[model samples]
Target chain A: MIFIKILSILVMLFYALGSAGVFWGIPAERYKILVLGKFFTWTGFALHTLLIISIILLNGADDLSRGYFMQLLAWCILLAYFIGWRLLKSGFLSLTASPLALLLFILALKVDKVQIEMPGTLKELFIALHIGPMYTSLGLLTLAFGAALLFLHMDRKIKSKTRLTEFDRGLPALGTYDRINHLAVVFGFPLYTLGIAAGFIWAPLTWGREGGILGSWDPKEIFSVFVWFLYASTFYLRILRGWRGRKAALLILFIFGISAFSLLGVNLFMPTHHSFGSLATFTA
Target chain B: MNKHICLVGLNHRTAGVEIREAFALADAGLLENGLLPVGAHLKKDLPIKEALVLSTCNRVEILLAGREEKLEELAIRSWAAARNRQPEELAPFVYVHNDAEAVKHLFAVASSLDSMVLGEPQILGQIKDAYKDALRAGSTRFILNALLHRAFFVAKRVRSETGVASSAVSVSYAAVELAKRIFGDMPSCKAMLIGAGEMAELAATHLMNAGIKSILVANRTHERALELASRYHGLAVPFADLFAQLPEVDIVISSTGAPEAVIRAKDMAGVMRRRRNRPMFFIDIAVPRDVDPDVNTLDNIYLYDIDDLKEVVEENLTQRREEAVKALAIVEEETLNFCKWLESTELQPTIVDLIRRSEAIVREEWTRTSKRLRLSEKDTRALELMLGAIVKKINHDPINFLKNRFEEEKDGQYAGLLRLVFNLDKKELCPRRTREHGSEEAPPPLGPPDGGMIPPRRTPEPAAAFFNRIKEGSK
Candidate 1:
């Protein structure tokens, strides 16, 4: 079992190395090499998800929110990465995703901060409400936030009227970057809504049937709704007045920051019902 | 005296831009003015088969492929007439090389070795345009076509394999880059070329290429200013109008040989007031300087003198002749290989004619023998077929052998030994296109070597020679 884990880790590392070579090395248009590298990365992701599913099934998914959170979130990001790369025709997708995935994979292997305790009858329901949507929301926010940063940098450079380097002229136009950021926010909004709804649904069943456990005052609940509203309004205003520029973009940038804190930042260094008891995770 | 090649060339490295333009084939049809005399002379003596003239700012060259001794003189007159001078006047300044030297000259010109700016790619493009004109005149053929294709490839190789074109730290390049950093691109801005010096001419050249519009050149010498402005089709103004025009032109480049500052802060104060909030690029390349240092005190005016421009030129990350070394190495390697192949091709037709003639005599003898003996139809057909197969089989080996060796060896006499070995030489004896020396033994590889290490196969037959190569590859 230990040996299998080591082999899997090595395969993931090879995928990252190959991805770096194609992205930043000799830069040949290697069709076969590209397909093969993507295959290894996806296969590693699949194995990682499978191992988490098996562990949850054996040990039970009662209070396993953090354990499942990191595992499922890494899986979701990889999922979105593959889909976005295919649909968007973006070349650097693998290059960016490789570093992010490698970090998450290392974190999953070593971080032992998750424990799940649940009643037998509500175990299946609890897992869905607690673990699934939160990870999905975090994945969506990660992509949206990355796109926003790229948009801001490109906008600043273009407006300054600086000389375009040989390579700078080759990048996609500022408007294209801005549009992609808007699209990422539009895509992420529903995932955030689903995560907030799941949190509310699981709160009553786990802590108490009183809706008092997950109230509007809870920082997680309040921030989640605020984020949903911010993105939703931005989406409508963009279509109504064609308001998509630096002003609208800066607003989107703030929303992403809020979304990140609500997902993982709030859980850390804070006392809240969101921080249920399962912290210590599996041993190697 | 046949149509080989006649080169009368002048380029940037050989003459100044003024001299180049003086002799430049400016009129569209000056080629006829140049090549017609060569053509008329070709009619009298070894004739000019075809002619083409390529004239650009960097080089003016006439490529004549004809069969004539006096054709070079005729080409010289053609150039003189274009320059409005006598042949005697133009003769001293020109180089007239023929045959392989002329062939090599045209190749080098097309490859841009003859360019004013060594290894400039514009000459290669100009050469292609020259070839296009030659096509319309119906003078382009196998020899010229092969030469041009090989020349273009050689240019590509020279660029890739050498650094001869790498270190072009020109003033215009520096100006373009600095302007870009300030304004991103100059397409929107108005460009001003102040003074008619060489630096001004170069800066204007760069600006025009960079797509800067509304150009105006101000100089104390109005005619010199006008002459420089006319080249790029720009406007000219008197030196007194420098301040008045500075407000209209966004970019100002001053390159006069002035001893002191020409445009002072007090002078630009009135012009800057009317300009409102526009950005100005001041490139001062004058030796003693042109724009006053105090002018930079005003907002939105970027100033750079010759020293500053030189600093920028020094800092260019790209080396101009970086590719030239690698490109020239490739050019030399490829040229050697190509010339070798060309020499081998000259021997092929003569060898083929010898064999075909041999085969004909055999056929004629077989028919005559069959007719005299009154042989049966079946016997006659079988005999004819059998004899034909023997002849073909005998000739096939040497033909394939000689053709393969052609690529490796340039000299034909080495490979033409097949003609002697086959004994297809006597006319009456062979009864076909035959050589006189049918009975002589096959020729040696190195012209009867001075008793050097004898050919490994100082043996009986070529089959032994075939085994030697197979054994060598195995080893």
Candidate 2:
């Protein structure tokens, strides 16, 4: 466990350096820096996988526990970034997406190893249903944020009549970024809806027959619904109202910010039904 | 000693366009004819070994591989005589580069770092074209072959590793980029040319190349508009209908050379209403500004004047200059790599001689021994074949080691030591000592020299040390 913990920290440090390299590489248009960033990113990812596997083998089924859930979410975000990067071939998005993953890793590292006791009546299948799509939605939303950032950057350059920077030239056309944002929301929204629905269905059995849709008014539940609404509105404005480019990008950015806050902040500070009294305690 | 790489030429920097134009070779035929006199001079009296002529509109550079420093004057005289001019006419406008500076110049030229419009991409293609011409003239050999191929690689590295060629530096290109920003890609959008002026025509051509849906040309003179439209295979609309058709066009490039603004804000109001506020990109490249500047204030209307585009170009140029610093580093690195390969070639003759001498001794001993033993014909043939393979195997590693070590050492000092140990005749391998003796007369320029591997003596030592020292100082 100590070795795993040390490896996790090493992975985080590698990700930080990699994120910095990619951030500076795009603007400078240096292949060496970009390659270095990729090297560190891959090494970090491999080390992170080793940590996750070790934790899973040592503490069986604890992979789905709240203690390791943030780490899983960070891994999912990196997976999503890799898929998008390969499919879209947008080098500029990597500059943003890599840093976002690093930030997630840093947040995950700080997350106290709190083991939340599973409800007695809750089935193992119900936990799987809740954790899988939940992380997928978070990962997809993270990618949307990266695409939105690049779209805004390119929009700023074009609107200002400024010369395109080395980074800007490497960016996908505004159309591609807009499409990525829209598609991520379209795909992630359904998965999120299913996850929330499963959580609602599973609540009655665990918390009692009276535990329903409005059972708890926790910050996590409220903000989850709030993020869903924002994402739904983005689709509504884009498909029906014909909002695109800057407006669409800005809305997706808002959705990502709130979702990120809900994922990290609400879990840390706010009280909720999702308790972790069995694990490590908070420091400060 | 290898022939020094030399570049003697005039560019937009050193000469007027007319002088460059006069010296520019338009095609392979012109290059061949241009090199005919220079090639003959090399064969007759000049000490030049290999030659390549790179002649573009912006520059006409004569790159020569030769022994004498005085080949520039001989080349210039031949070039002048070909064009029915005098040597003095071009002397003031021309500049000369020799040895490492010449190599650097070639690299810079091929990479477009030294171009009038910094980072312009056409220069690389132009350089490749010159290389092809040299191939056709049979004037390019190993030295030029190595230098030019390395030049292409360096150019490619510079382009990929820097942002030198990324931005639009012309008004026409800016217009295309503006259209792309407004309408995703220009090919899906329709464009209108409001005037037949050169700038407007240039923009139309650029838009056509970008694959615009359709181009509509509208001018005050109907026939002129028709003629200009026909050239691009576009539709020619009447000048009166320019306002009525504005709803269909996504981009408007206007440069009428009119004294006053032709299209005002009031005219655009009706056009915008008809178009349902779809974005309209206006590029006013005229001096007096054909389109009203006030129109830019309207919704979905983006207007850029000639001044705005010039500002963009200037900014792009500045960015290219910054990128050029990195590009120069790549060029210098590649130049050093080439110099090393060239220095390694100095050991080629010595290596060849070592093999030849060993084979001769074996052959002579075998002939004397075989006669005394009265060996059968089949046995003698087999013995000779076995001995030949053994000789090749024995010599392979030493030759490979010498080649690899010389690349790292960069000077032929080690190879020279090997030559002395092998007792190889230095004169037979390289005639560098002859040029060092300073006989003060030109060597006979005929069919070919007796020693094929000996190159012209320009630099006695590899320039890799000098250049590496300079790089360290800069750092």
Candidate 3:
């Protein structure tokens, strides 16, 4: 429990430092230490997942229906942290991913940790198919964001064409980062497409036939497709036409911004059952 | 002591490409014939004591390690003879140092601080190669073994902790990267490697590796070009035919050892006509580059020399300055640790001597007392325990203090007092003074300079010692 509290505090402080632009004159060992610290945090996340499951078992199956959103988001965040941990270990994505995971964990903590028991079979399957892919997509996009930031930093440093500061050594090469960002989009697309498909399939059962298909055309779903289009365009333009370096870097960044909007943004603005309580306005 | 290091010879720095080539020994073939003179001189006149010879196009440095008195010019005279150069001719340019200064020189050399171009890491690799060659030649002696290992440690500290090895440190490599942008893939292009200087090879090697198809080695001396060209498997084009070679070459990486720009604007303007509409990349890695400055203005040609490439290298270096500061802290930490280890070596003998003397005194006194006063077995056992505790208490501080003395050589006077009290044998505790006739007339060249380690300065508090007297100033 103490370790869990410490990790939460560390994650908050680390993100706050990043947001404040406090990075400078960092040692070679700095990220090596961060990687080790992040590994311990994943362990705490596992323990937290165990605690939530115990609470869900104590509650009856009927409660699983009403309170399942919190449970879905929690498991999604936990999976996000685990995969983020792997990416950081590979040195593909680093300090940037931690902040996003930290924010999601905080969001989970805000929601009820009192998880309810299992739902009806059809409902459970639908929930798993829809929520699991969305979380997986979120994690991949987080990795893309990390790569994109490094690419921007490296590009800025090169364009300035002045003396490199300590920051240059801390950065992966511009070409290397650009390639990683491209990879994220390549990997994230299929998973997100499947999630959208699953959401549509589960749509008829929850909202019912013609009405259900109408709910499936909710703004969140529309924007998800829009994001998919943006990323697919980036991949096509880059691979087929050799649109690389800075031009390619800027495009990926544009795609990442659209993705964040669809993940946290559409959730805030769009209406229908998929919307958060604060953002429920269905005009059509 | 065997702490001093002596280095003498010519490099790309002190002498031009001509002198470097004249003294260059590129093979073991030269070691037998050219180095024979050195062996004979060592046998007839003076022993080298300990020496290692490093000959590369950039520089030829002969590092000699020995007692300061034994490692003088006379010891290094044969090393000069190996190059077939007069002792005095090389002596004026030769630099010598002892102990700490010597270690600093080795560190600087390996870390590229002493390079013609700062932060070029090629020198460290060259030094390592030289050490290996020395071992193979059986030229390494006792002092050299220690110095070589210490040199590597110092280099590791400098590189890991300093910005010495970070960023685009080498101008030549920077030239190539920038050229890559201008030419894209250069496999379809032709490159001319001007000058056969060692530094030129580094730049040319990088360019050739980057997919430049035909690499032609051109120089003032045809023989030097022939020799160098054969090694890189490039064709040796004569200096007079430079204009002819210019027509076909797309990229010209010149590190010609000329003292001035050999390729004038008139020549470049003439060559540009032949280049047609093709984009030609000319990197003048040479200090006084072969290509003229105005050649950069020529259409369809990008000309960058040492001065221009340094600007890019400097820019990248500036970005690494923060990392450099962090590295310096690491260096300081490592230096202190090494200094501690050095002092510990000094302390070990003193500590061992003190323990031996203390135990002997205890044993002698205990036997005399037990014979006369102790009658019962229980009394004898009690007496032995009492004597042992007394010895332990008495011996504790002095031994511990000697070990602590390594922390800035504190209580410099305490060592003598402890030795006197314990009656520790002087011969065993201190370094045995040896007759250093290993080489004569080669006493360490002591130059008058105040370049010793800077003692930690005291920024006096305005309160003037807070609660204590300002003894020296008041007096």
Candidate 4:
């Protein structure tokens, strides 16, 4: 447990340093600092991977703690960032990924651990299918949100005909941001559907047919379905209608907002089966 | 003796373009298959060992290596004579640097520090071409070959270690930079030339060289548009259909001679819808602005008139000036290093004399002793091996001292001291040959009648090559 704590702190330090490097590098226009930032991010990623493996080894595969889930979410976000960085050949994503990863890791340290209980081995398989794709898709959605925000900012700067700031100069072309948004939705929507299908299948078996297909009219399940519909419509509009640029970027931002509410607010504030523990215990 | 490296020239700062053109050696056909005219003329009257002539539109310089006393005078006379002018007429505009200064000047010139535009890259290629001409004419020998190679190395060092040439200093280049920021990938973007003006044509050339996919030319005069389009292998569109073609190009350069705005916000709104809101860049370079200022308010359109481009160019030029300061420091550091190597070459003749004297003494003693002993062939071989080892061992400390002490003392003082201590100046064991035959094999000297007892004199290699061999052997 102490070793896990130490490793988590080291991961946090590296991520914080990487964020600082990106913030300083872009404005200064020094390429070496940017490369150093990338090196730090990769180092933090390696240590974070080790931390996750150790947590799994100590607590078993069924340890579905809220803190562990946050760590995994941060890891998946970085994974999505690395993939986008390689595919698009852009370093601007680090401006978002590094600081966000550090924030999530710090949040993971503050949140209480709450392990979920499972009755059968088949349910464990279903949980993996549900959690894995769901968090990965959420990670990609987070990146899409960042790309959309940058696109709008750059779009406004160009339209305003103002002198570009150093941060604006460091941004990739507006088309590059649109491409990232396109890639995220194209891949994230399908994986999100798979995760929803797995959850729907697991619900009836776990609740003993008392609550029907969805297991109950819980806020978590209702909001999840709503978020899925929003994503599906975004994907459809992007592909069939040839929607691009400002409209596509705006829609992606809206979908990401509702998805964030479903993932966090529905589980915490509302009455839902996905709540980690009792409200009294969570607040304490 | 140290070879005197000298440079005499007139550049844009020292002479006007009329004088520079009159003194240009390229017009004299120096690049043809013959000795350089100035070099051939100097060889007839002076002791010039090596010469190279560099002639460009901005400057004409002659780099020579010979005796220091009259080398500059002789080089100026020959240079002026080749151009059918008197030496006195061109002397006032000329500047001369000998030895260390000459090396520094050449390095700075090759690094583009001395260019008209501070960090322009064309000067290095011009110097390289001049060096190649000298090599073809067989006018450059030992000293010049090393100096030119070192100058090239210094130029590369300055370029890579500094940001001197990393920014755009011209209006066309600034436009290209802005376009890159908008489109990211230039090869996928198309460009439209709205006029056949020189500025627009220059921007079109830069865009094509940047690998823009295709170009469309539109002008008020169809014949002029056709002529310009044929040069770039692009299509010529009629001026009436300019709005229809505006949506197809990602970049538009407008310099039409119009009193009013050529592209308006209302027309661009329909074009933006047709382009699906893809980004479009407009570069307006006309006295009366060609692009409407209101068009810049549209969502995906970026417009820059001539004043904006001039502002970008000014910012970049200021950055280049800062970078050039760093580059000049590198040139200074490397100049000092090359001068140290030049100083080390003066020690070569002393080292050669020391070795030859030691070998001569060893051979003289061995011949007299062997004749009285009447030794067999195997014994003779053994004695010869022992004597050769003795000569090498005896000369080792003195040679080491001379090589190491030259770096600490003033030039050639340690060499002179060693010559005095070793009694190397008492007799001239070997007669000095003219520098032109300095590398040829020396004739056999008078030794014992046995003939093979004394070894043949070693052929002299250039000092730089000889020092490199010694360094490699030590390593």
Candidate 5:
């Protein structure tokens, strides 16, 4: 576990350096820095993988708590960046996603202060199915959010008539970034829908429908729906109303903010099965 | 004899177009005839070994490699005689580069670092063409072969590794680039050329290259429109059918030499209504302004005038200048590398002579041992192979050391000492045997050496304006 913690910190530092190096003025140094960053990141990823495998082997799936699941979210985000870096041929995507992954890894290290137990029935394949799609979609949406932020930054630079810096030049084409944003939304929204459906299906099985399958209108569940609607509206506005460019970037930015709030904030304040009993428990 | 490289040239900065044009060779015959007249005269009157003449619209340069110590006067005199002018008349405009400076100048020129429009890529192609002419005329050999090939490589490196040429500097290119931002990839969009003028044709060329699906040429003269349409592989619509084609095409590039507006705001409102409000890009490049400024106010209609494009061009030029700083660094790095290689070549004669002497001695020793041992033919062959391997391994370190370092005056003295100690004949040290023996070994191919110091290969796409790139990114 200490090894894993050390590796995660190293990953954070490397990712920071890599992101910074992409904007380096000298082309030669920029290449060297980018390569070094990748080397550290890959090494850290290996250590992280070993840590996860060891945890799973020692504790088994039942001991795979929300904290571990959050660590898995961090791993998934790194994996997505590696995949995106290959497919898009842009280092900027990795630069954008790395900090988010670092944040998740740090969160994973933090002690889970709140602990309320979930029903034993909730530990089935349905739970894994629900968590998998939810976290993966979250990772995908995070990528879209990263691209949207870059779009906004570049757009702002152009609008304000500020001279574009070397950092701005390193970003992918606005259209390419926008398409990446659209693609992440297109792929994530459906998976998120699946996760929500799986949550509803498991709700009845676990809770026995005594207080209603939705757990008596849980606040976390309501906010999750709110988060879903925000992202869903991005597609609706994009496909139907032809909202694109800056307008679409703005909408995705908002959706990402709300999704982050729903995922982290709701978990902290509201008691629900969606938190897997790791977050704060509210008493009426 | 030490062959010195020199460049005597005049560009837009050093000379006016009139002066440059007077010295420039405007015909392919001048190249094939074994000269630009100046090159031929230099070959005849001076100790010139090889020469290449790079003549573009903006400049005329005579790049020479030879034993001539006083090449500037010879080059200037020949240039003046060829142009039927006095040597003193052209002396003020001509500038000279010697040896390393000459190599640096060639690298800069080939990389477009020395171009009037800082990072335009056409200069590299022009350099390539000149090199090809020199090669065809049998005027480029040994030193030039290495230098010219390195120049092309440097150009390729500068282009791929820097953003120098990644922005449009011309108004026509800016218009097309802006159009791309409005309508992504414009390949499926129909574009109408509103006039058959030069600016319109240039814009149409840029648009066509950007992959517009179709083009419609419209002019007051039906015949002129037909001529322009055929040239661009587009349909020529009659002037009367302007409104009919206007509603169909998504992009309108109007450069008609009109005194008044060719497209009014009222006309665009109806066109927008008829087309169901699909986005339209109007590039008004005409001076008196072919499209009314008010059309820009209409919903779904984006109108950019000549001045707007000029502003884009200016911004792009600014960006290109920023990129050129990186590009010139690449050029300087490549220039140093080429100079190192040239310096290494100074050690080549000694290296070649040393290897030959070693090979002869090894053969003699092998024969003596074989005869004494009375070894079988197969055993003797094995021994010969082993000895050959030993010789290669022995030479590898010295060869690599000399090739990698920029050999200085001390290194040259070391080379001379080695030759003298080995009792090597100066005749055996003559590396230019191809010239002496009249052997026709082809010059090195005009590109980067295989597996050299260049970074990994990247597919070089045509340079696009940075504004369009950002605009598309914002999308």
Candidate 6:
């Protein structure tokens, strides 16, 4: 436990340092600092991976906590960023990914470590499928949100014909941001739908007929359905309707906000079957 | 004999364009033939060992490594004679930098810090081409080869470590930069030239060089449009088809002599709808403004008139000037490093002589003493080994002391003193003579100067002051 605590702190420190390096490097136009930032990020990621493996080994899959899931989500976000970075060849994504990951990791540390129980092996697999795909989709959406923000900023700058700041100069082209947004939405929406469908299937089997697909009208379930609809519409508009640029970017940002609230806020604050402690007690 | 590195040249600051044009070596078929017209003259008439002639529109510099005596006067006279001019006429316009100053000048030139448009990138490529020409002509040997390679390294260092050359300094380049900001991949983007104007043509050329897929030309005169279109291998469309072509291209450059705006906001709105709101860049270089200022109000439309591009150019030029200061510092640091290497080359003969003389004395003493004792073969071998170790031990301190002195003494005073103290320079005791026996030994081969690669002997105060004096005098 103490080792886990120390490892988490180290992960946070490296992430904080990496984000600081990236932020400082962009405006200062220093390549060495950017390289140092990348080194720190990779080191932190390696340590974070070790921490995740250790947590699963110690607690076992059946007794995982909400805090552990939060850490997993942060890891997934960083994973998404690395994949995007490789495909797009844009360092600008780190400008958003680094800070967002650091923030999420810190938030994960603050969350209470109350382990939830799962009854059987098949149910545990179902839960993993439900949560894993959902978290990964959210992670990609978070990046899409970041790309949208940059797109709007660059769009306004070009439209206004304003002199670009040093930070602005380091940003990728507006088209690059648009492409990232398009790719994120196209991939994210399908995984999100898969996650929701998996939850619908798992809830009936675990809670019986009393907890239907809607999970007895739980706020988490209602919000998940709402976010899925929003995501699907965005996906449809982007692919079939050829929606692009500012309007599409704005819609992606809106969907990401609601999805984040549904995933985290409803589970922690609202009374729902998806709340880890409540679900564990109800099962007992 | 010591070889002096010298640079004789005239730039925009020192001479008018007419004088620069007259002295341009590139025009005399130097680059094509890969021969310097003055190379043979300098090598035969003077003691020049290596020569490289760099001629660009803004400057022409002749870099030479040769005998220090009369180097400046003879190099200038030969360069003038090659151009069919008198030495007196060229002397007033030309400035000379020797030794360390020459290294600094070459580095500054390669880094584009000395360019007329500060931080322009063309100068480095021009230098590389000039070096290649000199190599093909067999004029650049040892000293010039090392120096040119060092200059290239310094240029690369400056470019990567500083923000110099990161921004556009001209109107057309600024337009292209803005287009790049809007559209990430230039090769996929198409451009349209709305009129056959000079500024529009320049912008089209810049876009083409940036790898835009294709260009469309529209002009009031169909022949003029065809002429411009054929030059770029683009299709020429009629003036009436301008609105039709607007929806096709991502970039539009307009400099037509129309009395009113050629592209209006409402028209752009329809075009944007047809283009599915894809981004469009309009560069208006016309006096009356070919693009409506209100066109900027439309979604996904970026419009920049002549004044806005001028502002961007002005801002970038200021940014480049600031970056040039950092670049100059890098050049100064690298220049000092190269000079240290040059000074070590001067210390090479003395260091070699010291080791060789010590070994000779040790061997002679061992041979004479062992003959009287009549030692066995094994004992003789052991004793010779001990004597060899003693010779190494004896030469250690002198070598270290000379190296230490070399770092402090820039004029080779300690090397000369070491020679005198050890009597290492006597004709009979000289290692070069004994090793070669009968054949005439060539001058020391100026190989790579990796040996004795120490920090510079003194601070850059004198070099900086000299640079400032040149800058002031040129003005």
Top model number, lDDT = 6
Question: Per-residue lDDT for B351-460 in model 3, tens only?
Answer: 66677777788899888877888479988888788888887888787677766754654433345445444545433332223213322222222122211121111111
Give the number of the best model, judged by DockQ. Answer: 6
Candidates sorted on DockQ, descending: 6, 4, 2, 3, 5, 1
lDDT of 4 at A95: 79
- lDDT at B293, model 2: 81
Candidate 6, B1-475: lDDT as tens digits = 2457889999999999999988878856542353343333333433565688899999999898764455677667767777888989999999899888999999999999999998888999999999988777767666788899999999899888787988888899899999999998999999999887777888899999999999999999999999999999999999998898888999999999999998899888778878877889899999999899999887678899999999999988888888899999999999899887777777667777788899888878877888799789999889889888988898889888878876775655566556656766453443644334432443232223221232112111222333455579899
Model 2, B127: alpha-carbon shift in Å?
Answer: 3.2
Q: Which tens-of-lDDT digit does each residue in B1-475 have in candidate 5?
A: 2557889999999999888877776463444554343333234533666678888999888888765576777767867777778989999998899988899899989989889898988898899999888877767667787899999888888888887887778988877766665555577789998886778789888888888999999989989989888988999998988997788998898888889998899888777666755668888888899999888766556788877777778887888888888888887787788777676666666677678888888988887777779888898788889999988888787666655542444234445435444645433332456544432443222122222232111111111222244468899
Task: Judge candidate 1 at residue A139 and give its lDDT.
Answer: 59
TM-score of each model, in listed order: 0.53, 0.78, 0.60, 0.78, 0.77, 0.84
All candidates: DockQ: 0.09, 0.20, 0.14, 0.37, 0.11, 0.63
In angstroms, how far off is B235's CA in candidate 5? 5.9
Q: Which is the better candidate, 1 or 2, if ranked by TM-score?
A: 2
**Residue B41 alpha-carbon offset, candidate 4, angstroms:** 12
| DockQ value for model 6 | 0.63
Better of 3 and 5 by lDDT: 5
Q: Which 10-residue window in model 6 chain B sums to the lowest lDDT?
A: B454-463
| Candidate 3 or 2, higher lDDT | 2
Q: Could you give candidate 2's fraction of true interface contacts?
A: 0.19
- How far out, in Å, is residue A178 in model 2? 1.5
Model 5 regions more than 4 Å off: A1-54, A82-89, A111-129, A154-173, A213-215, A276-284, B26-46, B76-92, B181-184, B192-198, B216-282, B286-303, B322-326, B374-417, B426-475
Model 4: residues >4 Å from true position, as ranges? A1-6, A28-33, A53-69, A87-91, A109-113, A117-129, A142-174, A200-284, B1-3, B29-47, B66-70, B344-404, B415-475
Candidate order by lDDT, decreasing, is 6, 4, 2, 5, 1, 3
Across residues A232-272, which tens digit of lDDT does each residue of candidate 6 receive?
89988878767788888999989988977876677668887
Model 3 bad stretches (over 4 Å): A1-96, A109-121, A152-166, A173-175, A209-212, A215-217, A228-251, A278-284, B1-91, B129-144, B167-172, B175-344, B354-394, B403-475
Docking class of 3: incorrect
Question: Model 1 off-target regions past 4 Å?
Answer: A1-13, A19-95, A105-169, A202-284, B1-8, B26-51, B64-78, B81-84, B91-125, B150-409, B419-475
